[model samples]
Target: MNLKFIEKILIVMFLLTFGIIWYDFYTFSQPQLNMNPDLSYSRLLEYIKMGWVKQVDLYRNNRLAIIEASSPDLGDRSQLFRVNIPIAASQLIQKLKEYDINFDAHPIPQKNIFIKIAYNLLIPFIFITSLIYFFQSSNNIPGFPNLPGGPGAFFMNLGKSPAKLTESTDDTSFDDVKGIEEVKEEVEEIVSFLVDQDKYTLVGATIPKGVLLVGPPGTGKTLLAKAIANEAKVPFYNAAGGEFIELFVGIGASRMRDLFVQANKNSPCIVFIDEIDAIARKRGGGYGSTNDEREQTLNQLLSELDGFKENSGVILVGATNRVDILDSALLRPGRFDRIIDVPLPTRLGRSEILKLYAKKLSLDETVSLLDIADKTAGFSGAELANLLNESAILSARYKSEKITKKEINEAFERVIGGIAGLAMESGKIKTLIAYHEIGHALIGSILKNHDNVEKITLIPRGEAKGLTWFKSRGDARLFTRAQLTSRIITLYGGRAAETIIFGKPEVTTGASNDIERVTEIAYKMVTVYGMSSLGPRAFIKLNKTRQFPYPPKPMMSVKTRIKVSREVHRLLKGYEKIANRIIFENRIIIDLLVEKLLEIETLESSDFYNLLNQYIILPSK
Candidate 1:
C-alpha cells in the first residue's frame, strides 16, 4: 500500500536471491555441498563404505550424489584432467565424501543452473502471494465479486454508490438546500407515499408511478431526490443514467434490470437516476441511421417502467436539466407523471443557500449576508454555495484569517465571468464603462415591462467588461415592439457611450455581444415577430415540417432578401444614433460616474439614480 512497504518486500526478495546466487558460486568448493575432490579416490571409498545411505531416494536414481560430510572440494576446473565419464564417476563420488560433506546432494537439474535456481526460489513465493491475494479477495466483500478492500484493489470499486445502509440520504437533507420550495414540497409528498403507502391505499388513493424533476442546472434537482429518500426512510437506489453503459453489450440493460430488481426488493423505495438525459435522449439524435444498442436500452427501460405492476412500490425519480430533449414516451402520463419544475433560485433562496454553505466557513464577523444576497440576484443554489467555498479557499490561500466582504464580492464576480485579471486600466477606460452602463439604465429606467434598473457595474461579470442589470417585472413575460425598441437601445448603450465621449473610431469591440444581441432582436422582430415593415411571418423553426412550426411564408424573391437586410441595418443604426444622443445630453454626469467607477468597480442603481436625480426625475419611489 505504502511505497516503503513495497520496497521492503522487494528488498527481501533481492537479498535472498543475491545471497543464494553468491553462495552457489563463491562457496561451491565449501565442505558442506562439495567435499574434497582433490583427495585420493581410495580414501573417499573408505568413508563411503563405512557410512549408510541416509537418504536413498535421490542416490537411487541415475543422478550421482555426493556425501555432504566429507571435508573435500569440487576444486578448480582443468582441461588437462582428460577424465573418462563412467571411469571417473565412482572416483568423484568417493572424493566428494572426503571433503566432510554431511548430506547427499544432486547436480541440481543441470539442464540450466540459472533457470533451476530461479525456479526453486520464485515458485513458492509466487504461490504464497497468489494464495494470500485470493483469500483476501474472497473474504473482502461477501456476496459481491469485488476486489479486496485493501489499498491495492481500492480503485476496483470506483463508480459504486458510496451511499451507506442508512435507509436514506441524510447528508443531503432538505434544510441544507434552499429555494425551489415548490419542488421540495413535491418531493416531500412522494416521500410520504413511500413511508405510508397503506394510508393512501386505504383511502383509495394510488401513488404516482413516477416523479420527474425538471430544471436548469443547480436548481437542486438531485438534492430534492435525496431529500425524498431521507424523508421516506427507505433504501435509495442511486445511479446515473450514463452509468448504465458499458464497453460490453447488454450491460447497460442488465445494470438497469439489476437496479430495478433491487428497488422492488426494497419494496417502498426510491430509484434516483441523475442526468436521465444521458440515456433518455432521443435515440435517433445520433448514430446517423440508428443505434440498436441505445434503442434496446431505451426499450428495456420503458418496458420495466410501464409494464411493471403499479403497486410494486418502486417509484422512479429522474433528474435532467435538458428534459425537453428527453424521449416523449418518458414524459407520458403514469411515467414521470408529475413533472416538478425546479426553477433557478431566487435571490432570497441564494441567501439561504449561501448561509447554509458558509455556515461553517470562517467569515469576518462584519460580513453582511443580506448585502451579499442583494448582490447575488440571479445566482443558482450550486453557484452560491460554490461562491462561498471558493472564497474561503481563496482566503486561506491569501493567508487571510477570515473571508472579507471584498472576497465575497470578488468571488461573485469570479463566478459570473472570471477573476478580474490584469485588465485594470489607468486612464479613461473605467469612465467609458460607466457611461456605457448609464446609457443602458437611462433607456431601461423609462420602460414598464422591464423592472426598474437595479445595478450598473464596470466590474466585469462573465465575458462582459460592464453590465447593466434590470430587475424583472414579476414573471418577466415576452416583450412587445415598444419594449423591444428600448431593449435594443439598451444593448447599444456601450457604443453610444463611446460615441458620446470619445466619438467615431474610438468605439471599441467591447460591445460585440451587445451588437450581436441587438442584431438578433432586430432580425427576430422582422422575420419572426413581423414587427418590422415586413409582414407577419416566421423564419426559423426546428420541427420536421421545417415550415416555421406555424405557417410557411409565401415565396420571397431575391429582391426582398436584399431589402430586408437594408431595413435591419437601418433599424440598428437608428437605435445607435438615438442612444448616442441620450448619452451626449448627459455627458458631464457620465464623466463623473466613470471617474467613480475607476475608484470602485461597481455602482448600484440607487447610487446612479441619486446622481441623476437633479437632472432627470426618475419615476417616484
Candidate 2:
C-alpha cells in the first residue's frame, strides 16, 4: 500500500473510533421524549380518579409511565404525559386495573456486551496501537529520522543530513567524458593525488581542501565531478546546496554540522555539492537580503571548511553557475584553494562531442558528424545529445531503421527554431515576408565581415513568419569595430528592403526583434565596447547595489550622456544607409528571388548563391 493511503486510513479509523464513543454516551444519557411534558405522580393519580386517563405504557423497568388522557387543562384533547412512579410495579398495575385503563408493560431491551466493550474500550485501544505502529513504521522511511522516544516524537531529525552516500564504482570515469579536454587534464591531477596521497605529502604538498567548478549551465561541470569520484575510487557524498537550508531557525546550521560529521567519519571521500551558491551567497542586509537561517547555514559551512579541527582527506567539490553571488569567505584561498572554469565547447570540441553522442545512434551512410558540428556552433554538450535523441525519435516516427540526413536536418531546424507552423498561402503577405528575408540574405552576402548565409525559408516557424540562418565559424573570441558594424548593417537589411520595395508607410512590425538587437549592439558599442566617438573608456559600471561594501558609482556629466546618445544614433544611421544602398543595388535579383521563394517557399545556400552569381559578381571574403 502507498504510505499516503495508510496515513489516510489511520486517520479515518481514529475519527470513527471517537465518533462511536460520543454516539454511545449521547444515546444513553438523553432519553427519547415525544414532545410531552413531565407530570407528577399525584397529578397522574388525580387524572385516573377523575376518569380522564385513557391508556398507559410502562418503560425502563416500570420506573416510568407514559399516559394518554384528556383534561380541561389540556384543552379537552388526548395528550401524552410522562410521570415517574414511586410505587412498586405491582401497586401501579393494581391502580391501573382499578381505574379500568388500557395498559401495556414493556421490558427494557438488552444490548450486546461485546459491542459495548468494543465501542468503549477495544476501538480506542486499537486506534492508539495503530498510531504508535504508524510512527514506528515512519522511521524506516527515507528522510525521516528515528528519535530517542519514538519515530513520531519531536522534530529532532530536522538537523539530520540529507546527503546521499555512494560507494566507489567504476561506472563513470574520465574516459566517458568528452568535449572538455583542458578541464579534464586539471581534474585528472586531483584524482591522481587521491589515488596516491603519499606522493604529494612526502614532497610537502597538500591537496586542495575544496575545488570550485564555475561555468554556465549544461557545460559538463557536474559530469567532471562524477568522473573524479569514479577515477579516485573513493566514497562520494552528494548533496544539493538547498538540502542544508530550511525554514526552521537553527535547522540549517544543525544540518551543516551533521554533514561535516559524516564527511569526517568517511575520510578520503569526495563531497560534491551542486548549486552551492544557494547557501553561500554574499551576506548583507538590503531589500533582497536572505533570511537568518540561510546566513546561519553559511556561517556553519565556513567554520567547517577551515575551523579549529583539521578537515584532511575530505576533498570538497562544488559546482555553480552563479559564482558572482557567492560569499568571499567561501572562495578564499584556504577554503576553495582551486577554482576551475568550464567553458562552452569550441569548434573542435563540438566535433568531439558530436562524435561521442553519434556512437549510440544508427545513422545513414551519407550523414556526417562534422557537418552537423559545423552547423551547431553555440550548442553545449547536453544540447548536442538532445539533438541526436530528437533525430532518433523522428526516425522512429517515420518507421525508418536508421536515422537519415533528412531527419537530422529537420531535428536541427526544430531545435534551433521552434516547430514549423503551417505553410503560408501565396498572397501579398507571403510576398512581403519573402522580400524581408531576402533583404537579410542579400546584405549578409555583400558584407565582408558578416557570416555566410546558410538557408532561407518562407515557412513560418515559432513567432517568425520567415527565417534566415547564418553559418558562423564559432571560433572567434574577439570582434573588431568593423565586424560589429557589419553585423548592425546586416540586421537592418530587412527593414531597409521593406522600405524600398513597398513604400515606407507599408512596412510591417516584422522587424521588432531585429530592431531590438540593433539597438542593443549600437548602445553597447558606445557604452561598453568604446567603439564609437565616445572614446576608448567604458561608460557603464557593473555590480552596483545598495548592499554592504557597495561598488563605486560611475561618474558621467549630463553633457557626456547626451554625447553618448548621439554617438549611438550616428552608428545606427550610418549602418542603416549602407544596408539601403546594398538592397537598392540588388533590386532586380531581389524580385527574381522573391518570385522563386514564393513558388518553392524554401532555398538552400548553394541554390541561392548559384542564382545570385548569374546576375552579379559576389563579394570576395
Count backbone overlaps in model 1.
22
Local error of candidate 2 at residue 63 (angstroms):
22
**Leading candidate by TM-score:** 2
For candidate 1, lDDT tens digit of each residue in 106-126? 343332576476768675775
Could you tally the backbone clashes for each prediction? 22, 0
In model 1, where do residues sit more than 4 Å from their true spots? 1-166, 169-177, 202-206, 288-293, 347-375, 388-410, 422-425, 428-438, 441-481, 523-538, 542-570, 595-607
Each prediction's RMSD to truth: 11.3, 7.2
Question: What are the models' TM-scores?
Answer: 0.68, 0.82
